[model samples]
Target: MTFSKDEQPKNIPESNTTDNVAVPKNFLIPFLLLSLKQWNMHGYKLMQVLLDLGFTTIDSSNVYRTLRQLEKDHYIKSNWEQGEEGPAKRIYSITEEGEAFLKTCHSSFLQYQQMLQTFFSIYTNSLFPISNFTDKND
Candidate 1:
């Protein structure tokens, strides 16, 4: 059968669902540890930091759960500080183990970044040949 250039490709299938599943709860541990590595913070401050980092949909319960897991794993330690105006807050800090783990995560993230750069370079170059062809006259 003949088809126009705008027609859908014969081999590709269409799907109606596009909603993305949530990132797993455990996924927040590394981020929490990394944040704590920079400074000791309470739950609210940590949540604010995460929100500022673009995690606006994160639930408070998830943050607290991750905090508990991190403490259980010995990656973080927390202490209660009595606030003058309100209830005591639990301040979290990264333990030595957490620092080491953060280093490993940082290295892995760097490698992943390099891999993504290489992949995109090849993929985009192949997809758009004109991207590599510069106008020398300019």
Candidate 2:
């Protein structure tokens, strides 16, 4: 079947619902640092918390890499804790600077949400105008 570049094959779905959409891994940095602010945890435990919080596709290496970058950037601090039966674990906690950074991130997130809301409103309204969705009784 020949199809133009702008067209999709008949069998393909046009849009994806929120439940099936995967959030990009880069979006988790703020969440990770916020969790650390609540309590210090090693990288593995942080990964587990992320998975529990619905970031199902997160990679351990990426988590560790982000943690390292956060530490290097002075947003977080870590210390080695002795383990009874294994190597010492590095536990991370949010620094004072991290708290300030988080506040900035929170503001950005709010603005981003508003931008998305505006975009979606225009997109859906364009695709399915209000008149088409109105109730017959009204």
Best by lDDT, which number?
A: 2
Question: For model 2, what is the alpha-carbon lDDT of residue 81?
Answer: 99
Tens digit of per-residue lDDT, candidate 2, span 1-138: 345657867654456545645566557888898899888999999988887878857777778888999999999999999989899999999999999999998999999999999999999899899889889898
Weakest 10 consecutive residues of candidate 1 by summed lDDT: 12-21
Write model 1 residue lDDT over 1-138, tens digit each, in one string.
345656857553333343434444545777888889899999999989876755646799978988898899899999999989899999999999999988888888799889999999988888788746888887
Residue 21 in model 2: lDDT: 55
lDDT of each: 0.82, 0.85
| Alpha-carbon deviation at 60 in model 2, angstroms | 1.3
